[model samples]
Target: MQRWPVLLFLAWVCFLFFAGIGLFMSGFLLTRIELASSSSCSDPLVPPPWERQSLPPGSCWAPQRFAKAVLVIIDALSFEFAHFNPAKTSPLPYENKLSFLHRLATSQPRHARLYRFRADPPTATMQRIKGLTTGSLPTFIDVGSNFATYAIQEDNLAVRQAGRVVFMGDDTWEGLFPKKFFRSYFFPSFNVKDLHTVDDGILQHLYPTGKHGEWDVLIAHFLGVDHCGHKHGPDHPEMAKKLTQMNEMLRSLVDHLGNDTLLLVAGDHGMTETGDHGGDSEKEVNLCCCVLSKFLIPPLPLQEPEAVPQVNLVPTVALLLGVPIPYSNIGEVMAELFSGDGDAVSAALQQLSVYHINAKQVRPTVGLPIELEKRRNVFLSTDLFCLVQVGWGHDVIFVGSLH
Candidate 1:
């Protein structure tokens, strides 16, 4: 054989051998990490196993009871922003000020509850939305390049259970849920020049026939805040103006809908000083949860409040809509929020306990296997982070900082 040909053959062999080894290592690490991450909490706060609590046998739509639920999620609205005002009395130096947001924060029917959890690790729009819609965190470690595919594959279980789910926002909003499962009302986030136009579109859809009885669940996400935050930092004048605008938009919805609707206002994640997110940075991922409605939203109370964890949103919403929760759901319904006697509350709690813990194995301690699994694969790659921007506008580049 010629010398050059022999050398080329040797190089090819070496490349194949190394590539094979690398792939095998990656797969092994992933499996090991997944296993380690599966440890059940020893003495886990398992809700009591399931007991049947039937709603009074009657029509689904009653005058006193809500026939529908509307969840309005404001992407990137931080709890810090919701509670703190740097320019409390002073006017912000921006043309499109967030006066509406400030007014809503101060004047709207509001509930503030301490959400107990570190900010979501996959600190991006789509991943957090997935967390809100489905009770599950992103499955992959790194933010995947093909996030839309992953999100649909994972599916938003909560949205699927609703009678009718109308999602109105940027195309990214459409990517978060499976297309086949839900009827989506999509709009180009980039096309609309005005935020109120988007809001109007949502209002029109909700009242297509000038009636609110159509959709069982209406989720409207306003992307301007997050959009502005990415271009300018969250604390920037431009961002503040947009926040105020969004706040006003929300207020408009509340004014139109009145007290009968439960309005949930939340930010998927916050931005950092650099106007970037995708790590577990405390500031980057912290969320703002503001519930404006006659009903008690999580962390808030109709009466004496109890400390429920942040994960409770999934089951709580599910129970209220009278939907059957999946076996994988881990959160419990906050029974204490309903206005009723002690016996009624106890029954609700008991019913919630049964729903949360049935068919799930209880692990008292964080098992070594589970911990190892999380440390290795779950935390190693950036698939989960990639999922955050699955249907987002920006190009996702892994800077190798899943530290």
Candidate 2:
């Protein structure tokens, strides 16, 4: 009888042990894996540009396009708000609110390109920001960590340009970069009820800091549109007022921009019909990205805007500023930013070379089978970057040569 009792207790212990192991394994498997590779400006693996033969390994291949760049984040500025639908006889309050953007894109087609910047869901701000900077996709599990802002572990755009970076608005940047900026102005973004505090805070520092010319890259994140969306749905009168304010602010910012500067405006994510996000609904994922500069000329004239993956921004921004692309970036340089007018072949070659470096950086971690790796290596070694012409066809024409 006593031995039976002992056997039962042993069985119970074994059950608990196995259950604990299973539980730990389940939790470990469920957690999202973060990429940990870091890249420096001097990495020898990245090849020098063909024309820029004297360039050292990992040295910036393309000449810097702009002396300065301004990145503006208008949270929750959806496609509906950015695009003015002509077909609707009576438009919603949120519709046609950003007249300035549409007008500029139409009037100065070469200078301004508006795109439907599609984000990987869950479209919460933090995850979107991660995707924007790191060029990595987020798992659904990341949505839960929206409130808990952790420092970015991977190589990011901000860190690569550290000390030369200036940041304003959205304290989330403060959390993610943490002393990475040369100058920073941050406001609490948690209070959804108050809209002006963050916007006004950005307004106070935005122009003055830009005029100071102390930084290379200026990042300003505006939360008014998003907060208004959260407090009152996009259809409300208040939403119209908020968007109008944004429109005016953008106009003023453009006036302040010199020819030497490039202006990049993007919505981190869009809101649903009810003005909530963090889901994969069409409205929530379709946001706006506008790149404007006196020098910029797109491959196509501004007609209806096209959709682009959000990750592409990282390489585009990096190359525009003459910086090394982040080591783990999986995105290709967006072709629309370059003009194919007289230099289509050169542009294609530059893009292919950039892709080759990006491929070299990312391939080791993907763990392809040995045979596949050999084939990929052979293809890369043989200047098969030219093969992109055959594979991409019409797409390569728009990618303006960097050399």
Error of 1 at 155 (Å): 5.8
Estimated TM-score for each candidate: 0.63, 0.78
Misplaced by over 4 Å in model 2 are 1-30, 45-52, 55-59, 86-89, 140-149, 301-306, 339-341, 364-403
**Candidate 1 TM-score over all chains jointly:** 0.63
Number of the top-ranking candidate, with TM-score as the measure: 2
Assess candidate 1 and give its lDDT: 0.50
Candidate 1 Cα outliers beyond 4 Å, as residue runs? 1-53, 57-66, 84-87, 90-119, 141-148, 181-183, 189-213, 258-260, 295-310, 332-335, 338-403
* lDDT for each candidate structure: 0.50, 0.72
lDDT of 2 by residue, 98-157 (tens): 888888888898788788888867798987888788776654343222446577766778
Residue-wise C-alpha lDDT for candidate 1, range 1-403, written one tens digit per residue: 5999999999999999998888655543221112212222232434434434433442211112344567776666665655545455764332225344445545543432333223445676666665666544444343433534544333233455555766665566665554743456666666433444454566556444213445567777776666666666665776666666665666566655645565566667776766677776877666656545554433324363322333456555655554543323344444533323346556466445534442232112333465432242223442322222211112232224243
